[model samples]
Target chain A: QQPVQSPQAVILREGEDAVINCSSSKALYSVHWYRQKHGEAPVFLMILLKGGEQKGHDKISASFNEKKQQSSLYLTASQLSYSGTYFCGTEIRAAGNKLTFGGGTRVLVKP
Target chain B: SAVISQKPSRDICQRGTSLTIQCQVDSQVTMMFWYRQQPGQSLTLIATANQGSEATYESGFVIDKFPISRPNLTFSTLTVSNMSPEDSSIYLCSVGTGPTTGELFFGEGSRLTVL
Candidate 1:
């Protein structure tokens, strides 16, 4: 099943912060985060494995809650380049490595 | 990281005609997947292409409609057969190096517009 993303859209100014949440009904083995620019393919940002592991890069971070089957992406000091759609792909099982992506959160950052 | 290339980046086709998209990876990959993204929508998994084996499609997708060919480990093709207006979307091919890495590299994607 497809995961659910909250705050369908968010607008921020440069140097601001934002949080996007993705929740799934099924148990997830890993949660992957990606960003897609206009007319471009989705680019992989980071992956959060089960066991309550959290990963981050240059003010962008993500956490996975195994018990709750949810993941949250945090973007701090947002830059203009942060304007795009964010998708969370969940891996329910480790067998096929298949992923079900969320509806996506559109983020717009102004200068 | 894998460098994935797709042919015919964008195309305009007539309804009832079919188009085949090709995906080539720089290195050998264990798993290859096809996904479709409709206008203003999220990506949806169409099928999983396994080398030398029949492709495994998702619930809403069928082999006859989206036939996939994975002749080797580094190459694959997805053919949208008997296309229609609804088939107009961005088709992407992704390669997974391994299941444990949880990372997927994607091709630029083929943009198809059926009129």
Candidate 2:
């Protein structure tokens, strides 16, 4: 099943903070985060592994709780560039390239 | 990371016709996948294009309706056969960057508007 993302939409002003959450019913080996701007392809942001291994840009902060099968993406000091849709892709197996993306969270960072 | 190019950024097709979307990656990748995003909706996995083999489709998707071809590691095609209004969506091509981490690089996507 696809993962569920909370707060379908959020509007943030410059320097504000916001958090997006994702929950899955099945066991997840990893959770991948992506940001897609208007009229553009989704860009990879970060990935959190089941064993606590994380990879991606340093500025992107995220957490994965395996026991609860949930992941949270924290956007601190939001900037205008952060205005976009965020999606969380969950992987169920090790080395499983296939991912089921979440419903996507729309974030609008205002000036 | 890989650079992906998808053909026919947007197209208008009539019902009962078919549209084939091409995806070309600058670098050869181990895994490639296709996804569909409907109007104001989330993305749904269509299938996984396997090199030198038939594509693996997800549940609620079939090969006959959506034929896929992975001629090589760098190129793949997805054909929407017998199109309908419901088939209209943004089809995205993505190449996996990590096997364990599951990082995927996506193409610009082909937007289809079926009337």
Candidate 3:
């Protein structure tokens, strides 16, 4: 099943912080984060496999709460490059490597 | 990580026609997946293409409409048949290194506009 993402869109000045949340109705085994720039393919950001696991990339970090079937991506001190559409992909129990992606949240960071 | 390349990076086709998009991986992979993303929408799995077997498609997708072929471990193709305007979307080719790998390497998607 597809995940539900909060704040379908966001606008922020450079150096501001933002949080995007993703929740799924079904049980999840892993949650993956990806970012897609305009006219580009979705790029893998990180994957959280265990419950309460947190991973970071530059100023971007994500936390997975397997118990709640939810994951949150944190973007701190956002830069212009951080402007893109973020998608959370979920791999649920018995789903193997197949991922169901969320609707996506568009982030726009301006100077 | 694997490098994937897709052919016909973008195309405009007339209704009632068919278009085949090709994907080539730099190295061998176990599973190849095809995903479709409508404009301003999330990625939806079209099917899983595995070597030496028929493709497994997701619900609302059928081989007759989105035929997939995996002749080898590094290459696969997805063809959209009898296209309609609603079929316009970006089709991406992806693959993981192994069975349990959570990260997928994706090719520059093929953007199709059916009119």
Candidate 4:
């Protein structure tokens, strides 16, 4: 099943911060994040393992809550270049290459 | 990161017609994935192709409609058969960095417009 993302969309300004949350009904072994700009392929951001791990890439960071089967992405000091749709992919089982992506969160940062 | 190249980045097809998108990778990959995304929509997994085996398609996707061929470790092709306007979307080919890591590198994507 596809995961659910909250705050369907968020508008931010440069130097602002925002959070996007994704939750799944099933237990997950890992959570993966990706960002896609208009007319482009989704780019890999970071992956968080189970056991309440947190990962970061540049100003973007994410945390996975194993107990809750959810993950949250944090955008710190947002930049205009960060404008895009964010997607979280959940891996239900270890070694399972198959991933179910959540409904994306569209983020727009304006100067 | 693997460098993937897709052919015919954009194309227009007539209803009931077919179009094939080719994907080539710089190196051998253990797994290749096909995804579809409509404009302003989330990416949907179509199938997973492995060399020397039949592609495993996700629910709502059938081989009869989207046939995949993995001729080698570094090349694969997805053929959209009997397309309609609903099939008009961006088709992306992604390569798994490893079997367990699950980090995917995506191709530029083939944009198909069916009329």
> Which one is best on lDDT?
3
User: How high is each candidate's TM-score?
Assistant: 0.98, 0.95, 0.98, 0.98
DockQ scores of the candidates: 0.70, 0.73, 0.72, 0.71
Models, CA RMSD each: 1.0, 1.5, 0.9, 0.9
lDDT tens digits, residues A1-52, model 1?
Answer: 9999988999999999999999999998889999999999899999988658
| lDDT tens per residue, model 2, B33-106 | 99999877778999999999999999999999999999998999999999999999999998986554556899
DockQ of prediction 2? 0.73
Question: In model 3, where do residues sit more than 4 Å from their true spots?
Answer: none
What is residue A11's positional error in candidate 4, in angstroms? Answer: 0.6
Pairs of residues clashing in candidate 3: none
CA lDDT of each prediction against the hidden true structure: 0.93, 0.90, 0.94, 0.92
Superpose all Cα atoms of candidate 4 onto the true structure and report the RMSD in Å to 1 decimal. Answer: 0.9
- Residue pairs of candidate 4 with colliding backbone atoms: none
Candidate 4: tens digits of C-alpha lDDT, residues A39-107: 888899999886589989999999999899899999999999999999999888875557788889999
Which docking band does candidate 3 fall into?
medium
Report per-candidate TM-score of chain A alone: 0.96, 0.92, 0.96, 0.96
Candidate 4 chain A, poorest ten consecutive residues by summed lDDT: A91-100
Q: Give the range of the ten consecutive residues with the poorest summed lDDT in model 3 chain B.
A: B97-106
Which residue runs does candidate 1 get wrong by more than 4 Å?
Answer: B99-101
- Candidate 3: fnat, from 0 to 1? 0.66
